[model samples]
Target: MLAYLADVFSALSELNHSLQGRELNIVTASEKLAAFKEKLVLWIKRVKRGNLVNFPCLEETVTENSTLPPTFVAKIVEHMQMLCTSFDGYFSCGELQTCNIWILNPFMQNLEDVDDDGSIKEDLIDMRHNCGIQMEFTNSQLDHFLASQREAYPALATKGLEVLVPFATTYLCEQGFSCLLHIKTKSRNRLNSEHDMRVALSTKTLRFDAIMEKKQQ
Candidate 1:
């Protein structure tokens, strides 16, 4: 989950960079950035609303589940929290543009430290000015941005968004192996190479079958 959130935040940062690259005037760029931020905030709100009602105590329940260790559940919860907090930071498109302006206009005699929470006062001054008509993205251009974001994760590039399934499944497999080790230690019989080989092969076959079924669908 940490990896997933990292990927998402990284993608958003990349998207911001792309948006800043447009040759539009400051006012036009600011408007586009504001629109993007609004969309992101709406997405976050939708996620929170659904999660609050459907799984109000999901984290606590998962933590208490005996089949899975608390540490693993804690990690998941930590990642979820990171996602929530980071989204709030990223949703401030105006602040993001202000930071970009500081970098591009180094010749400006004075600059103030504009942290994430700072008002985008610099851009607001030119809010009514026309920066000329902004160019719109073609379908191909949009596709390129999406492709670049997904390329950050190889699984996402290959299997698309369903990449999370395999990632989570792999983690679960590690926990299963740990439990198997505990069980083996309790048994009197020593580790049998042949038996272990057969068990591993069966597990691999099952996983492969599942992957194939998903692909077929």
Candidate 2:
């Protein structure tokens, strides 16, 4: 039973790890969540049919024992059903159509399909033809690319920013806690960690070579 659950949780753990990290946004989170739910549905069907390919450890144990008890197999199916119900209740597709299309590729989106006034559509048309900015959009991060467009394409960029900014706050809180642990040691028990904590939590990249060149030996 424990081995069977380990297989189930191993799949979930991989999904959880993929959704975490500093750079994660709703776009990536939504895609992963949708894929995981689909896998759960497929697993439920496979397990019901006695297909243990998805659960290697469970299969190995059953092979050694000649067969798994009927009661425990039923329990596993029930557990998977409960998980699918819980996930469906918690997550829903809430991002707007324009936001999704813009993130994928602004140039490719049809102006008619965009859910906006004429102004945003006009901005999109202009952006599609601007080869210079198009190159930058392809090269840069979604949030950064949208940010750079704010001056030239306020409406379009603002909509994208609304979707791209505000990534997982839970991730930020956990990151801050990890940084605190690294900075606060037994030897430095008396030290004030406010300044060091800021540096550790900051998203800015530090240039060690430039700092060393400026420092007096």
* Candidates' RMSD to native: 19.0, 2.5
TM-score of each: 0.24, 0.87
Clashing residue pairs, candidate 2?
none
lDDT of each: 0.42, 0.81
Which candidate number maximizes TM-score? 2
Residue 69, model 1, lDDT: 47
Tens digit of per-residue lDDT, candidate 1, span 143-194: 2322443433332223222211123113345545765665466463576545
How would you encode candidate 2's per-residue C-alpha lDDT over 177-213 as one tens digit per residue?
8888888889888889999998787789989789999
Give candidate 2's whole-model lDDT.
Answer: 0.81
